[model samples]
Target: MDQYVEILHWNTQHGRKLDAAIAWLRKRAKAAGRMPAALMLNELQPGQGEHVGGELGLLHYPAPVDDGLDPADSRRRNLNAIFIDPDGPLVPDPEWVANWTGPWMPPATLPVNLRNPDGTLSSRQLYLACEHACYWHPGYRETTARFYTVLGKDGRLVHVDGDFNAWTVGRAPLTLANVADRAFAQNRSVLCGTALVADDIADRLMTAGGFVYVHGHAAEYLGIEGADAPTTDHGPDKERQLIPEEDQPERGLSAIDRTYTTAELIPAVIDANVITDPDVDALADHKPRYTRYGYPDLVAITNLPVELVHH
Candidate 1:
């Protein structure tokens, strides 16, 4: 079947990485003899005022068709849309973009109440709202954001000097209503702390439905006694650790698990991986996670029957 993919909100730095990904996909499609009809790359232009708009000029690439097949055949033209952002700075606010002139309009809007204490929308809030909107939007088959350690100039993982804000919402089946409720509730349920545990311990906690945010001095903060706590042995020294482990007692063990609201967990994961990664200041110069969008709610959407696309 023909697929439609749209990539939204990518900057110059992301362009090179995206190009490599697309090339790999195209090569694979050719091997399978199921190449797509067309691919589109939509860049984010500076929006008017505080909002941002997609660049009008789309970098479109048409697939090379077979010799005998007609290019206009409907069966030959499936659509696949992919949205790529190394760091998700732009929130897809449809209401704000309705009047704007562009081929791509944001698929959703931010809820009225998800604002900061000063009655303004924070970047994190805006991204969360967009994620909430995508969850329920019929047009999107699925969505996700992935978090990874940021690299430093010395060709190593960057270290976070300050406290790691392990922000967390609740578990999955997250909907717009509950997300808004959590965001606006006077005494909303969320988990925010700076605790780091042993990698094995973190893995165990995640297995139980919880998440752990680790960073510089995480070993000392969590009192990890093992040697694995301070090295880059299991991949990059993870800036943060997020597990699915639920809030519960340590039982016979010394570690403890805490459950979080969906609102708290989603942004917490994003903050650790994307919004506040160690290289936030030098994002353009560092290598970001290959797949930059993920959260439990979004992960749920991914398991559904949607066309998979990424950068």
Candidate 2:
């Protein structure tokens, strides 16, 4: 029942550290009655400071001969994979998670929704009002900035980074129009954070016969526990009694006090593609997997395929 095993190498000795780690993992895998399907070695790169590691090489253990080795034995081949530690400097941050307040700078304008004088879309609106309602954690700001840029460029649609905020924004008459435009461009599949948003977006888009890629919360959809979830700071008004309950569950709900940013969303986009690589699609679509799983603490990662159940 040992489905997957990952080994992280951090020896500054470079090649030697990698070799040593692989050897150790091989022995461990053998004892566990498991054969490595692939061995990926990630070593530190040059001048990446001491934190960075190199390429993550994958070593898959063939069946039978590679299985059932003693954990204490050094020659054991019971390994799912033998690779360097994932947490290295060269690894890029995931776009889905948002940015950490590192040395990176913030965006010039807060990408948000525009509003009219009546708190709705104006017949003659001048500038788009970016929704400054979502949560911007210290580290996740970088992600928010990037998301804003993408949304701004693709003005035809409203890229709702599915969290509570998207609903709040969608409820806005003006913002809803943009959402409708994008949804119509695609099917009724605006990438949503959760099925909740996905369904909601689909309904609204359907009103105008429109849709977009519904980006759901990978953590929830994929059953990834302990992972961080995106959030925002906006919510529906308590006194707005005209809206139907089924029409808008998020109306009464509040915005996420904290949320993920664009810096994080990028890597997520990659990882989702990699982990969900189906029918050997991963062979060509595994780069994001390498970058995302390169973190040291991440032992086993799963990229759930965007299946029908998820939708």
Clash number for every model?
Answer: 43, 87
Q: Write the per-residue lDDT of candidate 1 for residues 1-311, one digit (tens) a residue.
A: 11121112112232334434344445544574543221222221222101211321222221122334464542123211223221222223334321111111221212111222333433322221111111112222111111111011111111111101111122221222222333222122222254222212222332233223332112234343331111111123322222213331222112111111122223222221111234232322222211112333333322234232332
Model 2, global lDDT: 0.25
Per residue, candidate 2 scores C-alpha lDDT tens digits across 33-134 of 542322232222222222112322321111112224353432121111122222211111122222222222211121111222233321211111111212
What TM-score would every model get versus the actual structure? Answer: 0.21, 0.20
lDDT for each candidate structure: 0.23, 0.25
Off by over 4 Å in 2: 1-165, 168-215, 225-247, 250-311
Score residue 200 of candidate 2 by CA lDDT: 31
Number of the top-ranking candidate, with lDDT as the measure: 2
Reference-based lDDT, residue 260, model 2? 26
Candidate 1: regions farther than 4 A off: 1-16, 37-239, 244-311
Error of 1 at 2 (Å): 7.0
